[model samples]
Target: MANIIAVVWDFDKTLVDGYMQDPIFEEYNVESKEFWKEVNSLPDKYMKEQGVLVNPDTVYLNQFIRYAKNGTFKGLTNKKLFEFGKKLKFYKGIPDIFEKTKKLIEEDSKYKEYDIKVEHYIVSTGMTQVIKGSSVMPYVEHVWGCELIEGEDKDGAPCISEIGYTIDNTSKTRALFEINKGVHSGDSREGVNANTKIPEEFRRVHFINMVYVADGPSDIPAFSVLNKNGGATFAIYPKGDLRALSQVEQMRVEGRINMYAEADYSEGTMAYMWICNKITEFADRIRKEERDKIAKYAGSQGPKHLVD
Candidate 1:
């Protein structure tokens, strides 16, 4: 059986104080509010003018390209996106929590015996280049996000020209399965589609071994996927931001998220405590499963009096 526990995360408000791409807007002097206003309107705008119903989640990538081509976001390139990532203000405990969670499975003798390990992944609708450049990237095992294709602009400067791939809210489920099946690790060549034939015992990481953390309603699709499949979900709302809190609270009431916490992920914060507890629980459960399996086949479970 695979001894892996995956903690998948959503970007944006979940990790940083605000959007990861906010630096892009600030750097280019583009009004972030106005750009988002346009992004929010594009789907309906296209449907009305051309009868094409676009994906609201990732249509912003096209707008990013449009701005680059028009010189509004002049010289916006993958390199620039990476630079912007460094400016992001990540919430408290971020990358530290990543390493801490992984270490949890190693501290206990029982946990260590089973070889259970935690792997961190980011599945976001934000820019991949930006996420890769963030302070937290060093702790992350893999990232899934909207990627940009770079090409030469008129001045022969490399610029972001096209949307290479998009991991919208709905598609985040696929990334989860990719983790579940170990696709990103290159252990499962059959891909996520081969899941039905792959038994739970053999799959890289079972759904029960996953914990998904995100921000709001846009994560409903991902939340539902994990909830329905026996995984856990946690929501993070900005501290003192009632609107953000309300959004997550409503999701909890709707059964989308298993729990909600303030964005601070510091060592003693709710987010940190809850996540660590979940990891401990998952490790213990895996230990039990492994022990039970061995006992079943060996027909020897040691002495009941000696069992703790």
Candidate 2:
């Protein structure tokens, strides 16, 4: 048992509401819904016009999937993309969740025995800088999300040259590989750390503790991955978001999530309370098992061996 070494989070709709709602898209005279509809409608012709050289099915399918799932766009220069990122906002009580989760990680006795260290990470397909500039940045360990190609303008602020669209389950796994354990993309397996191997870890421990909270279909892949890996995932449906609720139900039906609950951040809110309870239960189980192990080991030792 170990104090939670890391806690990963999904940005955009999870920690914040309406980031992908895209007011700027609306401001730019493109309704996101209309844009998605148009993109889906023009698959073959659009791919041909863009001169996309990749697998046509992959490109076209991902065009719609990315837009619907993660709100990605094509042909946008990184500068304009980052500019759009700068304007996003968060949901109510988000700041408090960080402050409180941090405090609990530090002060809770059950977690303390695990030498639990808490690291907040955002796995998002949204803009990195958008998350970086938010109030939550100071609390998180690292952000793995869409990055802009780094180029400076006349004012010396980094401009977005291209959106990497670098957050999702697969990318999240890659981030865990590269950042946490220095595994590079396409690197030989020989170079990787054994501890970071997810499959091996799952096999060794009947219960590997993790908690993931996410908002919508975009999070399904991530939730599914975490849940399948012997971790718990909570699907959150924010108030006023019927779409999120619908997605939650679908995820439940697919057996893709561990739990589904409303997205609320008040100390007494269902989401907050449920997460706290789950963390507490995991911490308690690990702590009790660790104590029993220690006691058993102590009892197995020869008494006063030095006296002999």
Candidate 3:
């Protein structure tokens, strides 16, 4: 069997310094802090006043749609989203980490016969259009996130019609399963929640070969899913950010993650070394299992008969 390893990441604070919406806000002349403040508060306010529950995960997308309808962002099209992506900045070594980790596994002598493959994925609550347009998009195999529905052009400007897909904190686990099942973001949604079952051995990426990396509490569900399934979970924080460091420490103490490190992805950093070592460990185990299986099969073939 070909050995496959998956590295799944949470986008917002894990890869970038701040929210991905910063550029979108900038383009629309909206204040980043105020936009997020309203996005976080509107749902709660609506629930209290209207006695109706509005999903917090989707409210921001809806707000964008509302803004488009109100002519606030006349040219907020998919193209614009991608353009905004180009302006979004990422952390230390980001996209480089993907290639470096892959090289580390492939070049190792112990994994010579093993067809070791490393695949990267992003599961975020951010906008899919923006993420697809980002610099790290090329490095990731798939990106699962909230999506916007586009409508007819208004004065030659693309308009957002509605919220198509909304990914929240807890729902992020679904993306991990999708990755495990080899379902790409562009693939049909049927596979993600299908009744037809796939045997464990046939699954594309085994739990033991998974690595889930995220920044904080919002990713607890993903961390729990990976850790409970024998996969690795890593909690990362910005360097010198005491609050983030304290939160990561709390997560580790609570047993929500297997390890915690600074968000630095540069070569020789703790995050890089830890991931490289894990790949090596996973590869070694796979090689040993193959050998053991061969030995066991050979032993089952009771004494070979010698014919003269």
| CA-lDDT, candidates in order | 0.88, 0.60, 0.82
**What are the TM-scores, per candidate, against the unseen true structure?**
0.93, 0.72, 0.91
Once fitted onto the true fold, the runs of candidate 1 whose alpha carbons sit more than 4 angstroms away are 186-197, 300-308
Whichever of 1 and 3 has more lDDT, that candidate is 1
Highest lDDT scorer? 1
Can you tell me which runs of candidate 3 are displaced by over 4 Å?
152-156, 185-195, 299-308
Is candidate 1 or 2 superior in lDDT? 1
Per-residue lDDT over 1-308 for candidate 3, one digit per residue giving the tens place of the 0 to 100 score: 63788899899989988988887777778887887788899977988899989877668887787778778777677777877888888889887998888777788776767677777898899888888887887768888898888884455557877778889988898887777776773433454542336787866788888999999998999898888889998988988999999999999999999888998999899998888788777777888888898889987967778999
- What's the best-to-worst order under TM-score? 1, 3, 2
Q: Model 2, residue 169: what's the lDDT?
A: 48
lDDT of 1 by residue, 1-308 (tens): 76888999999999989998788888888899999998999999999999998999999999998888777888999988988888998998978999888777877777888788888999999999999999988778899999999986666677899888888998898898878777776365653562456666667889988999999999898888889999999999998999989888888888989999999999999999999999988888889999999889899656667666
Candidate 2, residues 135-211: lDDT per residue as tens digits?
A: 78778766777655544433444433333455544556555433344232122244565255545432222224667
Q: Which ten residues in a row have the lowest lDDT in candidate 3?
A: 187-196
